[model samples]
Target: MKNLKLAAAIAAAVSCGPALAQTEIVWWHAHGGQLGETVNSIAEQFNASQSEIVLTPVFKGGYEDTLTATIAAFRAGEQPNIVQVFDAGAATIIGAQGAVIPAEDLMTQAGVEFDANNYISGVRYFYADSEGKMVGMPFNSSTPILYYNIAALEKAGVEPPKTWEEFESIAPAIVDAGYIPLAQSHSPWIWTENFHSRHNLPFASNNNGFDGSDGTKILVNNDAIKMHFSKVKEWLDKGWYAYYGAGWGDNQTPFENSEVAMWLGSSGSFGGLLNSVDFEFSATYLPYWEAITSEPTQTFIGGAALFALTGHSDEENKATAEFFKFLSSTDVQKFWHKETGYVPITTAAYEAAKAEGYYDEKPQAEIGIKQLSLPSGDNSKGYRMGFYVQIRDVMNREYGRIFAGETDVESAFNVIEEEGNKLLDRFSKTN
Candidate 1:
C-alpha cells in the first residue's frame, strides 16, 4: 500500500546510516480552522512519502494578511518559497517584478512533471497570464452561486428564478410571505464584479485589463450598472434584501438561521452550510440580466491560488516546485475536493470524482463545473485589474452608503466610478 510505503520511507530515512538531509520548503497560506488541518495533513503525508523533502505549510492569518506578510518577508529577504494568494491579489502579485517566480516556470526549472491543460478551465484561466499560460498553481478556487431555500420557494409557489428580472418579480411575494427574499454578502463581488461579468459587461476599457492593467479606464458607469444599483437600492428600501455587514460569516448566518430564503454566496461556503443548516437548500447558476437571456454566460472564479515567491535559494525553490507537483497530482486534487467544499482543479480529478457519483449526491456542485467550463468571453476569463483592492474598498464603502440610504444610487455610483478609476489610473502609472 502507498501508506505502508510512505511509513517505511520515513522510518528508513530516520534510521539510515547516513541520515538523509531533508530539503525544507515553506508554504505561506490563508486558510484557518479545518482548512488548516487539511493543509497540515497534506504536508505530513507528502513528508512521509519522500525522504528528501519536508514541506512546511504555515498559516498566516487571512488572505490580505498572508499577502502582506509575504511581501514584507520578500523585502526583508525572508519570504517563503510558496504563498497562497486570493484572486483579487493576482494582478498585484504579477506586477511585483522579480519578486515572484512564475509557477509554471518554477515547475519546469525543478523538472517537475506538469501539464497546464490538466487544470479546469475556470481555475486555470484565473491564474493564467496574457499568453494563456498558468502563472501560478490553481488551488481552492471558487465562484459565487445562488443558494435558494427549497421549502421557502415551494411555500411561495414558485421554483428558483433563472434571471435577475424573474428574481425581482418573485421577491415581493417572498417578502410578503414573511421570508427575506435575498441575503447578499457585502462586497462589489456578486453585486458588481461578478454580476456585470456574468451578464457579459466589461469592467474596464481594456477588455477588463486582460490586455494590460496600464491606462485602464473604469467603464462601469453605464446604463446597466446604474440600473443594477437603482434596483439594489430599491430592494434595500423595501426591506426585501439584506447585505452581509462587516464579516464573511454574516451572509451565511442569515441563510442558515432561515432569516433569508435566498442567498448569493461563494460555492466554497457550501460545505459549511451543509453542516450548519437544518433546512433544505439548492445551489444554482448566478442570476443573469434579462438582456442576456439568449444564453447563460460564465461567472468568475472567486477564491485563490498558490504562487511561488521569489528571492529563495535554488534548493528551496526546487523543493517548493516538487511540492507543487505533489499537490497538483490527481490523488491530492481528489482529496482536496472531497475534504473541502472547493472544487477540484484538474479535469482528471473532476471526472474521477464524477464517475464515483460524488456530484450526483450533491446536485448543487454541478453548477460549479458548468459555470466554470462555459466559453471564455471578456468577462468570463477573469479580470486582471490593477489596484483591485483599492477599487473594491471604494465600491464597498460607497455602495454601503447607497444601501444604507446615506446617498442616492446615482450619486454613490458616480463617486464609486470616479474614485475607482483614479485608483486604476494611479496603479497603471506606478506598475
Candidate 2:
C-alpha cells in the first residue's frame, strides 16, 4: 500500500509540472534609481494580480546603451519580449520593419479592448502610425519645465522669470549674489530640446518627422537658436552658469542641492527633486525666446515607451498584448504618474487624478500636465528621426568644442549641421 501511494504522488507531480510554470516575460529598459524601483514594483504588482505570467524588469543602462544592447541581442536572437525605447529612437524602431510587432495589433489579437482614444493625442501621435495605429505603449511621458529654487530666488530678491528677456536679465543679478544662476548640464541634447522649444523652431523638416518621407535637416544655426546659444555663452563667461559633465544623472544634483537657482529639466525629475530638497522649490512653464514668439508652445515629451518585439508565437504575442492593456488601464497609469512623476498618458487618468485632488496636494506635479496640454504646433510635438541618438552625440561634441573655445558659435554650428546632416542621411537611407 505504501508503494502504491508513492506511485500516485509521482504521477500527480508530473501532471502539474507545466501548469506550475509561469510564462516569463523579460522587459529591457533604460530606467534606473527611483524610476527603476517603480518599474519593478509595477511588474511585481502585475505578477501578483495574475497567475499565467511573470514579468522580469531588467535595467540595460542609459537610453543609448539600452538601444545598442537591444540591437545586439536581436541580432543574436536573444532579444527580450519587450524593450523601452525613448522618443528619439521611435523612427529607428519603426524602420526595423521585421523586428517589431505593432502594439495596437498585438492588443487586439489578445482579446483586449484597446482604444486609442483613451490616450492623450500628443502621447499617442508619437508612437502611432499615420492611420493612428499604436506601435508601442506610452510608459513614462514628460515635458521640459523650469525648476526653480524659490528660497534661492528670494535670497537674491529676484522673481522667477516669466519671459526669456526677463530670464536673461536676472542671470547677472543671480551670479552677483554669489549663486549659480543656471545649472545646465554640459550635455547638448537637453539644450537642443530647450533651444528648439524656446524659439518655436522646427528641428527638422516635415513637422519634425511626422509629415513626410523626405525630411530635411535643420540645426542650431538659425538666428533664434544662435542668439540663444550666444546668450548661454555670455552667461558662462560671466560665471552665471556652471557646467556639470555629461554624466547622465549628475546635472540635476546642483539644482536639488540648492546650489543653482534655476534649471530646465524633464518634468519626470519631480520625484527625485522633491525627495532630495529641503528648500522650497517651484515649477513653471519653460521660458521662451522673446524674439521668437509671444506665447509658449507645447514642449515635447521625454521618457521611454514599451515596444513589442517580433518572432514570438501567437500565444506569446497575445500575452504581451494583455500586459500592455494592463499597463494602459486608468488605474495603472494613475499609479505610475503619481508615484514616478511621469505625466499620465491618458486624458481619463489625468482627469481622474484631478478629481481625486492628486494635483491639488502636489502643485509641482501639475506643471508637466499643463505644459503638455498647451496647444501643439509644428514645433511642439517633439522630434523623431532615425539615428537621433547618434545625432545627439554629435551635437554634444560640437557644443563641447564651442564651450572649450575651440570654435565660435557659427563655426561650431556649421560643423553640427554638416555632421548631423550626414548622420540623418545615413539613417534615412538605411531605415
Candidate 3:
C-alpha cells in the first residue's frame, strides 16, 4: 500500500512540473481602464508564450502614486520586481543608488541581449544615465502635438495654425464661430518644459541636469519663455484661450465635446479620442514661436518606463528581462503603439508600421514620430531635472496666478524660477 501511494504522488508531481517551476514576477503599474486591460493582455500573451515565467501586473494608481508606493515598498524591503515610472520621476529613480538595477545591467546579468541603440534616441534619452545606459525599459513614449476638431475648423473658415502668431490671428475667428479657439492642459509639461524644448530654449543649467544635478539652476524665466507666456496671457485676457486648471485630463473635455476648436495634448491622446469622440479631428505639430527660432526643434518625450527594482532574486530578474524582451519585439511594439497611441519605441517597430501602410490609415499616429525625429539640439535632448514633480507643481501654482490675472506674467515666471531653484537646491543637497 505504501509503495502504491508513493507511485501516485510521483505521478502527480511529474504532471505539475512546469507549473511548479514557473516564476511569478509582480509588476506594479499606473495604467488603468482600457490601458489597464491592454497591460493585462500583454502579460497574458507573455505568460502563454513561455511556461517558465508568469507576469502578474497590478494597477497601483497614477504615475505619481505608483512611484510613491514603489519607494515606500522599497524602504520596507517589499517592493515589486518591476514598477512603471513616468518621465518626471526618471531622474529620481536614476539617482536612487542601489534601489534599482539599470535595465542594461539587468538584461546583461540575466543573459538577455539588450542594445540601447535599439530604442529611439528621442524616447531613450529621458531614461538613460550619464554613460548613456538605459535606466529603464522604454514602454510608452509620446510628444505633445496639436489636435484640432476638423468640423470646427471648417465652421470657423480657418485652417489649423502653424505658428503662435497665426494661432493668435485665427483665434478671434474661431471664437466668432461660437467655439473656444484654444484650450490646453495646465500641466507644465505641455506649456512650459516641452514648450522650452520645442523652441530649443534652455529650461535649466548643467545641460538641463543631464551633466549633473550639482549647480543646476532654473533657466525658464528667460526672454523666450517670457515672450511665450505673455502671448498666452494676452489670449487669456481676450478670452481666446480657455484654462481648464491643472493636470492631464481636465482640459480634454472641451475639445472632445467640440466646444474648443484646438487643444494641445499628448500624442497618446489619439487612441482614446478615436474611440470616444463623435467628430472628426486631425493632429499636427505643436505651434512654435517662429519669432523665437526660425523653426521648431524636436520635442521631448513624455511617458513611463518599466524599472526593475532591487532585492529580487536572479530568477525574477531573468523573468523580468524576458518580459522586457517580449515588449520590445516588433509585433508587441506595434500592438502597444496602436492600442495606446504611444510612439513606437524602436526604429524597427516604426518601420513595421510604415511598411504596413499603418501611417496612411492613421496619419495622426505618425505626427509624433516625425516631431520627435526632427533635428535635436542640446536643449531638446530632454530634461533630467531632479524632483521635477515638485517643480511642475510650482509651475502650476505660479502659472495659475498669471492666468487668473492675480499676477503679471513676468512676476509669475520669476516666482517660478525662484521657487523652482529652491526645490532644485533641496534635490541637489539630498542627492
Candidate 4:
C-alpha cells in the first residue's frame, strides 16, 4: 500500500509539473487592414515552427504613431521586444543611444547566423550606421514608382513617358482625352527627396547626412530641383496635374475610379491595387530628366524595418533573433514579396522569384526591383538626416504654399531650407 501511494504521488507530480513556459514576445507594428492580417499570419507560422516562443503582433497605428508609442514605452520601461519603424525614423531611433539593440549584436549574441550582406545594397546601407553596421533588420522596402491606367493611356494615344520631357509632351493629349493627366498626394519623399537622389543632386549637405548629422544643412534650392518644380507648377496651372491637398489617400480614389491616368505611388501599393482596381493598369520607373543625367540613377527606398529594443531578457532577445532569422529565410521572403509588392530584401529571394517566373507573369511588379538594382551613385546612397519625417512635413507644407500661389518656388524652398535647418538643429542638440 505504501509503494502504491508513492507511485501514484510521483505520477501526479509529473503530470502537474509546469510545462515549458513560452517566451511571449510582443511586436508592435504599423501595418493595418490586409497587411495586418498578413503580419498575423507570419507570426502564426513562426509560432508553429517553434515551441519556445510565441510572437504576438500588435497593431499600433501608422508609422509615425508607432514610433511615438515605442519612444514613450521605452521611457516607461515597457517597450515591446520588437518594433517596426519606418525608414525616415531610422536615424532618430539609432541616435537615441542605447534605446535598442543593434541587429548585428542581437543576432550574434543569440547565436543566430546573420549576414548583413545578404541584404541588397539599395536597402542594406539605408539602415546601416556610419561604420556600415546594420542597426535594424530590413523589411517591407519599396521605391516610388509611376502607376498608369493602360486604357486611359491608349485612348490618349500616348505611351507612358520615360522622361520628364516626354511626360510634358504627352500631358496635353492625356488631358484632352478627358482624364486627369497626373495626380499625386503630397509625398515629398517621392517628389522632392527621391527625385534629388535619382538625379544625383544634393538634397542636404554632408552627403545627405550619411557622413555625419551634426552640421547637416538643407540644400533644396538647386536649379534642377527648381526646374522640376517649375514644370510641376506649370502642369498644375494647365490642369494637367490635379492637386488633392496634403493627405496620402485623398488622390487614391480618383486614380482607382480611372478618373486619373497616372500617379506617383509606392511600389508597396501594387498588391492592394491588384484587388482594388477594375481597370487594366501597369507601373514603371519614376520618370527622370534626361538633361539631369545620361541615365536615371538608383532610386532610394521608403518603408519600414524591424528593430529590436533593449531591456528584454536574454531568452526574449533570443526569440526576437529567431523571428528575425525566420524573416530572412528565402522562402519567407519570397512569400512576403509575392503577397506584398515590396522588393525582396535578399538576393536569394530575388533569385527565387526570378526562377519561379513570378516577375514574368507580373512584369510591372519587377520594375521597382530593377530600379533599385541599378548602380548606386554618390548622392543616391540614401537619406540619413535627423528628424527626416519632420523634414518631409516641412517640404510638403512649402509645396502646398507653392501650389496655392501663396509663395514662389524659390521662396518656398528657401522657407523649407530655413525651417528644416531649425528642425535638424533641434534634433542634433537632442542626440
Candidate 5:
C-alpha cells in the first residue's frame, strides 16, 4: 500500500509540471508609470486570448537605460525575445546588423496576416529601410502637442497660442499676470524635436538618418533653429519661462498644478495630465513659426517600437509574430489608444475609434491624430540616425549653456554643430 501511494504522488506531481510550463517569451521595455500599466494590461489580454504563448513584460527603466541593458544582455547571450527601443535609438538598432531580426520577416514567417499598407505612412517610414522593409514594429507612437491649463489661461487673459509668433507675443503678458508662460523641464532633447518639427527642417541628411550609415549632418546652425533658440532666450530674459531642473518627472508638475499656462510635451503625456490636473485643460497642435513658408509640418514619433532579438527558436519567433498581429487588431489598437493616449498606428484602428465616437467625446485626443495626418514631405516623416540619443544630450547641454548666458546663440550653435558632427562621423564609421 505504501509503494502504490508513492507512485500515485509522483504521477500527480509530474502532471502538474506540464500544466505550469507555458512557453514564456520575454519582452524588455522602457515604459513606466501609467504607460507601464498599459503594456502589462495588453500582455495580459494577449495571454488570455491565447494559450500557445505567454509574454512576460519586464520594466527596463528609461530609453537610454533600456538600450544599455539590452546591449549587455545580447553580449551576455541572454537577450529577450522582444525589446522596445525609442525613435532616437532606431539608427543604433539598425546599425547593430546581425543583432536583430527584422520585424517584417519575423511576422511574415509566423504566417501572421499583416498588411504593411494598413499602418500610417508617417509612423511606418521611421521603422522601415529604403526598400520599404520594416526593421521594427511600431508601438506606442506619439507626436508632440501643446497642453494648456484652461483656468490658468483664463486667469492670465490669454488664449492658446495658434502660431509661434503668437506664443512669443503672449509670453510677457502671461508673466505679468503672475503665471509662468512656459514651463520647461531641463530636458533639451524634447526641445530638439519641437524645434526641428516646427520648422520642418531635417535633423540629419539621408532622410533624417534613415537612408543609410553614410549620411550624417548637423543642422543646429540653421537660420530657423537659431531664430527659435533666440525666441526661447527672449522668453527666458523676460522671465516668462522657468527652468524645472533636471528631473523630467517633476517637470510636468507645474502644468498639472496650474502654475504654468502652457507646456509642449508628448501627446502620451495626456494620460498623466488627465489624472493629475483638477482644472479644465485643452490640447492643441504644437505651435509653429509663422515665418516658415510651410507651417504645421508632421511631427516625428517620440515613443518606442518593438524589435525582435536574435536567437529565439522558430516556434518562439512565430509566437512573437502572432502576438504582434494580435496587438495590431482593430479592437486591441483602439483599446490601447483610448486607454493610453497613444496614437493608433493603424488606419483601421483610427477609423474604428472615430466610428465609435472616441475622438468626438475626447476632443483633445484629436490633436495627436491631426499632427500625424499633416502633409509629409521628406522633412516631416521622422528622424533615423546613429548616435542620435547622444546628439540629443549634446543639444541639451549646448542649449542650457545658451539659456544660462554662458554663450551667445551663434557660438552655442557653432559648438553644438561641430561637436555633434564629430559624434555622427564616429557613429557612421563604427556602424
Candidate 6:
C-alpha cells in the first residue's frame, strides 16, 4: 500500500510538470502619458506570450531624469535590467562599456539571432558601432519633419514650403493671415542637431563622429549652421516665428491652439498631433536653405534606444534578450508603429505595414519614413559627442541669447562650439 502511494505521488508530480520560474525583469523607461501606456501594453503582451519572463516597466521621468535614476541605481548596485536612452546620450551610454552589455553582444551571448540588416536603415545605424554592430535596440526612431496647418497655408495662398526661400516668402502672408508662421522651440534639437543633418553639413569632424572617437570636437560655427541661426533670428524678429521652450510635443501646442500655422517637430508627434488638433494639417520634408543645398540629403535620428544594463544574472540577460526578440518581431513593431507615432524600427515591419496599406490609410504618416529613407551621407548618419547633455545646455543658453536678439549668430555660434568642446574633453578624460 505504501509503495502504491509513493507511485501515485510520483505520477502526480510528473503530470503537474516542473514549476515555471517567473523571473522578474525590470525595465526603466522615460516615456510618459499615452506613450507610457503604450509601453506598458507592450510589456503586458510580452508577459502573456511567455511564461518564463515577466517584465515590469517603471516610468523614470524624462530622458535626463531616467539617466540620473539609472546611474544612482548602478552606483547602489541595484540597477535595472534595461534602460532607454535618447540618441543624444547614446555616446555616453556607449562610452560606459563596462556598465552595459551592448544589445548585439547580449543577444549573441543569449544565443539569439540579431542581424543589423533587420532594422530600418537610418534607425538601426544610429545605435550601432563603426563595425555596424548594434549597441542598443533602436526603440523609437524619428526625424524632424515639417508639419503645417493646411487651412492657414490655403488661406494665405501659400503652398507648403519646399525651400527656406519659400518659407521666407510665405512668412509675411502667413502672419498677415492672423497666424504665427512658425512655432519653433528654443532647443538644440531643431536649431542645432536636426539643422546640420537636414543640410547634409557635418556637426562634428571625422564623418560626424561615425568614424569613432576621432571626431570629438564641436563644429557648430560652420557656415550652414550660422546661416540657419541668422535665419531663425530674422524670422523671430518679423513675428514669423514664435519660440517655445520645450522639445518634442511642446511645439505641437502652438499649432493646435491656432497660435502658429506651421511647426517643425519630431515625426513621433504624428499620432499626438492628430489627436490634439481638429484642423486640416499635413506633413512634409523639412525645408532646406536653397542657397546652401537644393534639397535634403538625409536627416538624423531624434529618438531613444534600448540598452541592457550590466551586473545582472545571466538568466536575466537571457530573458531580456528574449523580450527584445519579441519586441523586434514584425507584428509587434507594426502594431507599435500604428499605435504610436514612431516609425517602425525593422525593415520587415515597415514592408509589412506598407503591404497592408498602412500608408494609404494615413498618407501624412509616410512623410517621416520618406524623410529618413532619403539618400544617406556621413553627416546625416548621426552625431557622437560625449557629455552631449552638457553641450545641449550650453547651446540652449546661447540660443536663448539669439532668440532674445542679445547676440549675433556668428558670436553665438563661436561661444557654443568652444563651450561645448570643453565638456566633451572633460567627459573624455573622466568618463
Q: What are the models' TM-scores?
A: 0.94, 0.89, 0.93, 0.93, 0.90, 0.92
Ranking by TM-score: 1, 3, 4, 6, 5, 2
User: Candidate 1 vs candidate 2: which has greater lDDT?
Assistant: 1
Residue 259 lDDT in candidate 2: 75
Q: Give one digit per residue, the lDDT tens place, for model 4 in 161-197.
A: 9988899999999999999999886458888878987
Cα RMSD to the true fold for all candidates: 2.5, 5.3, 4.9, 5.9, 5.2, 5.8
- For candidate 6, list the clashing residue pairs, or say none: none
The lDDT of each candidate is: 0.82, 0.78, 0.87, 0.87, 0.80, 0.83
Model 2 stretches astray by more than 4 angstroms: 1-23, 130-132, 211-215
**Count of backbone clashes, every candidate in sequence:** 0, 0, 0, 0, 1, 0
- Look at candidate 6 and tell me the lDDT of residue 158: 92
lDDT of 3 by residue, 4-36 (tens): 644654565467684587788999999999999
* Tens digit per residue, CA lDDT, model 5, 196-292: 7656788777767677868477766788878778878888888777766556666688887777888877787777678877888889887778787
Cα error, candidate 6, residue 387 (Å): 1.5
* lDDT ranking of the models: 3, 4, 6, 1, 5, 2
**Candidate 1 per-residue C-alpha lDDT over 57-163 given as tens digits, one digit per residue, 9 for 90 to 100:** 99999999999998888888898888999988988898776878888899889898888888888788777788877887888878888898999988888779888
Instruction: Choose 5 or 6, whichever is better by TM-score.
Output: 6
Tens-digit per-residue lDDT, 240-287, candidate 2: 777675664677888877778998787888887788889888888877
Residue pair clashes in candidate 5: 209-384
The digit string of per-residue lDDT tens for model 6 on 234-300 reads 8888888888764545666878898799888878888988888999888998888889876677776
| lDDT, model 4 | 0.87
Write the number of the candidate with greater lDDT, choosing between 1 and 4: 4
Provide the lDDT at 423 for model 3. Answer: 88
